[model samples]
Target chain A: MPDHPFLLEAKGLSRHFGNNIAVNDVSFSIKQGEVLGFLGPNGAGKSTTMKMLSGNLAPDKGQILINGIDLLDKPAEAKACIGYLPETPPLYKEQTVSEFLRFCAKLNNIPKKQRITAVDNAIERCGLSDVSQRLIGHLSKGFQQRVGIAQAIIHEPAVVILDEPTSGLDPIQIREIRQLIREIANQHSVILSTHILPEVDMLCDRVQIISEGQLLFIDTIETLHEYMQSSALLLRFDTEISVQQLNAIDHILQSERLADNTYRVTFAPQHDPTQAILSKSLVEQWQLTMLMPEKHSMEDVFMKILREER
Target chain B: MLTISQNELQRLFLSPLAWIILALSQLLLAYLFLTHMDYFNALQGKMSAIPGAPGVTELIAMPLLSNTGMICLLITPLLTMRTIAEERRNENLPLLISAPISIYKIVIGKFIGTLSFFLCLIVMTLLMVMSITLGSSLDWLQVLSGTLGLVLLVASFSVIGIYLSSLFKQPTVAAISSFALLFLLWIIDWASTNAAEFTLLSWLSLLRHFQPMVQGQMNSQDVAYFLIIIFAFLLLTIRRLDRERLD
Candidate 1:
C-alpha cells in the first residue's frame, strides 16, 4: 500500500446463485493510480467480483467502500465514482459514437456545460475522433472495444472496472488497448478482469489470481517475476548420460534425463554451475551442446498453483 | 433520467419502426374519421329534427377520438416493443443498470421516452380532427376531455408495454405479450354477464373507464382509476428491473 488512501476497499465479498457459490469471501483494496489485474480462468469469480465492486450486483455477505463511502449505504453517491465496462460492451447500434458516449457521460451525471468537454476528452483519449460520427455497429471489433473503454472512462470516474476488455482483439489491437489501460491507470485505479495471462503481465502493476471462486494469490508483478527465475538449467548433449553421473558433477543438486541426449541439471541458487559443467564436460569428453537456465512462464506458475490446490 | 430518456427517444426516432407504426395508425384513424363525417352528413337532417340532437362533437370528434384510442390499443405494442427488450437482446441493459442512475430512473425514463413518441402519434391524430372546427360548430370541452382520456388510456397501455418489455429479452415476444395483455384487459368486460361479475370486470377492463371521460364526463373516480393503474404498472416495472439487475 502507498501513502495515498485506498480508492476502493471491498471486504469479505461473496455472492451465491441458488445453491452455487459464484464468488467466495473475496477481499481486495485498490489504491489510487494502481492497476489491479484480476486474473482467473473461466468461471473463476472474476466477473462476480467485478460486478460487486462496480455496484451492479450487491454482494450477499460483504460491504464495499468507495472513496471512504459505503457503497450499499450510499449507492448513488458512491457509484458516481465508478466507471464499469462488462465483458460485452453495452452499445446501442442505432446511435453514432458521439451520441452513445454522450449518453454514457450523461448517465454518469456529467454536468450540462462540462458534458461536451468530457465527451470530447474521452473521444480523443480513446482515439475515436475519426469514427466519432460513425455508428458503433458499423465499426470493426477493435473500435467497438475502444468504444467500450471510452464509455468506461468517459466520465473520468475515480475507479474504472473493465471485464475482459480485450477478449477478442488482434495482437495490434490488444497492444493498443494495453497502452490505453496504462494511460488511464495514471490517474484512476483500474480493476481489469481477464483470463489472458499476458494481459496481466503486460499492463498490470498488481495481480490477483482466482480459481474455483477463491482468490489463490495476490502479489506484485515483480514478485511474480521472481518466481519465474528458476535455478534449474536445461542441458543438451551429443552423448547420452546417466542421471547419477550428471549429478556427480560439482555444484549440481540433482539431475534428470529429459530426452535421449538431454538432461535437466538443477544447481543451488548461488552456484555458478555452467562453468563447472562445461569444464567437466571437456575433461570427460561428454559432448555438452546446449546450456541454459529453464525459463518459467506464467502458464507454468498457473499450472503449478492449480496442481498444488488440487 | 432525462439523459436516459433523451438517448432512448433519440434512438426511437432514428429507427423507422416507430415511424411506420405512427404512419399506419394515422392513416387508419384518418380513414375512420372521414367515414364518421360522411355518416354524420348523411344523418344531419334526421339529427336536426330530433330533440337535443347529436352535433359534430357527439357525431365526429367523439367517435374519432375513441377510434384513436382503439388505434393506440392496437399499435402501442409495436411502439413500445423495443423500449427495453431491444436493449436486453443487444446485451446492453447491463450498461444501463450499471450506470450511476437508479433502476427507477431507467424504468421511468424508458416509459416516458416511449410514451412521448406515442403521445406525438396521439397529438397528430387529434390535429387531423381539429379540422372539424374549421367547418362546423364543435364542443371544445368534449374534444379536450376526449383527448385527455385517450392520453391517459394510452399512457396506461404504455406502462404495460414497458413492463412486458422488461420481462422478456426478445422484442417480438415483448410485442406479442404486450398486445395479448392489453387485448385481454380491453375485452375483460365480455368475460362476464352477471351483476357480480359485471361490477368487477367493468372496473378491471382497460377501456371501460375511458368511455365515460370521452363522453365529456370528468369523473374523479375514473381519473383516479387510470392514475392508479399507471402507478401500479410503473411500480411493477421498477421492481422487475431491480431484480433483473441483481440477476
Candidate 2:
C-alpha cells in the first residue's frame, strides 16, 4: 500500500451539528486505484464523513489533503481532484442526460474541447448511451443513478466519492452498477458508502465500518474474514436435535439452539470440531441435513462491532 | 463562471415561462404603444398651437421604455427565482459547491446568466422603438441612456433575486420574497415622505434614480446608487453561500 503515493489523506477529521457529534476525529486515506468501502447502520456518520471529504461540508476540526494540496487552504485546487455523488444525485430534470453530463464536465473544468468526448465516454461507461438523449426526469431511478456517477467521473478526477450509489436500484441495476464501480476502481481511487454488505465484498479492496460517529474497523476484507472466523459451526437436522444430547459430545464447549432443528455449536479454537461432530452425528443417525463450517457473514461482524460498542 | 451562466441562460430559454413572459409583455406593450399613438394623432391639432409640442419620442417611445422597465420589475423574479433555488430543491447545489469554483464565481455566474435573459427581453422591446425610425427622428443618446439605466436596474434586480434564491430552498418562496423586496425598494420614496425627516429614504428608491435616466439625464450619483445596490446584494449572496458551506 505504501508503494504508491497516496492520492488522498485525511487527518483528524471531525464535525458536529449543534451539541451532537456527527463525526469525531476520524481519519483515513486512499491510495491510487484503491476502492474503500464505508459501511454503517442508519445515522452512523457515513454521509457526514463523505460530505467533509467532498468539501460540501466543512469539518469543525480536521485537515484533508488531495495529492498534498491542502483542501482547506486551497479548496478550489483540491476540489479539482475530487468528484462526488451524494446520497441524492444532483440533476436537472429538464436537461437531457448528455446535456447534464456536458454541463458537469464544464463545471469540473474539463477542457471545453474535450468535453464532448469526456461526456460521451461517461455516458458509455455508465451504460447510459441508449438514454443519453432522454430527459433526466423521465429516466428511471437506475439510469438517474448512473447519470450521477457519470457526472462524477466526467472530469476523470483522481478521487471519486459515491454515497449510496446503488441505494434504490433493482437487483439487475445494482449488479450493473456494481460492475461499473469495479471498472471505475481499476483507474481511480474510490470511496463508496453503502448499506449493502456484499457490495463491499464484491467491489471494495478494504472496508471501513463506522458506528455512532466513530470508525469501528478499517481492514481488508480478507483480514476481516480471518479475524472473525471462529471455531463455530451452524448445524441443521431434518428432525429435532436435543441440546442436552448435543452438549454430551467431547470437544464441544457449548451448543446454542438457533432454531427447532438447528444449533450453533462452538468448540475450542485450536480443535477441528467438524470431524468430531460429523462422527457423533453419524453414530446417532440424527438425520443430519446440513453441517458446515460457519462462514460468518459481514452482518455478524458488523453486529459484533456494534454490540461491543454498546 | 461563464459556463454556469450559459447553462442558466440556456435553462431559462428552455422553460416555457420565459417565452410566455417575453411574448405576453411584448404584446401588452405594443398595445399600449398603439393606443398612445392614436391619442397623439388626435392631439395633433392642438400641438401646432403650442410652442414646444411633445413628440412621439416623449409620447410613445419614452413611456414604452419606462413601462417595459416596470414590467421587468414584475417579471424578473420568475426568471431569476430558480437560478439557485431550484438547484437547492433538486439537490444540485452541492454540485456547484463541490466543484472547483469559488462562491463568488457562482454568484456572479448566476447574475450574468439572469442578466443575459433580461438583455434579450430588453432588446426585443428596443426593436419596437427602432421601428419608429421610419417616421420621425429618434434620440439615440436618450435611448442608450435609458438602456444603460435599465441594465443597471435589471442587474440590481437579478443580484437581489439570486441572493434571495440562495436563502430559500423553495423557488416559490424565493420568487415571492424577491417581488416583495423589489416593490418595497420601488415605493420607499412615497413611504419616506409620510414619515418624519426620512427624506434620505428617497435616495434609496430605485425610481428616484431610474426616472432621471429615462428622461435622458445621466448623473454619476444615480449610477453609483444602482451599482451599490447590485454590489451589496451580490456580496451578501457570496457570504451567505460561504457560510452555508461551513455550516
Kindly state the fnat score of candidate 2. Answer: 0.85
Evaluated at residue B171, the lDDT of candidate 2 is 94
Clashing pairs in 2: none
Question: What TM-score would every model get versus the actual structure?
Answer: 0.94, 0.94
Model 1 lDDT per residue over B84-103, tens place: 88888887887887687888
Worst ten in a row by lDDT for model 1 chain A? A1-10
Highest-lDDT candidate: 2
- Cα distance off (Å), candidate 2, residue A106: 1.3
What value does the lDDT take at residue A187 in candidate 1? 73
Candidate 2, residue A174: Cα displacement in angstroms equals 1.9
Tens digits of lDDT, candidate 2, A79-181: 9999999999998888899998989999988897998999999998889989999999999998899999998998888999999999988999999889999
Per-residue lDDT over B86-120 for candidate 2, one digit per residue giving the tens place of the 0 to 100 score: 88888899899899999899989999999998899
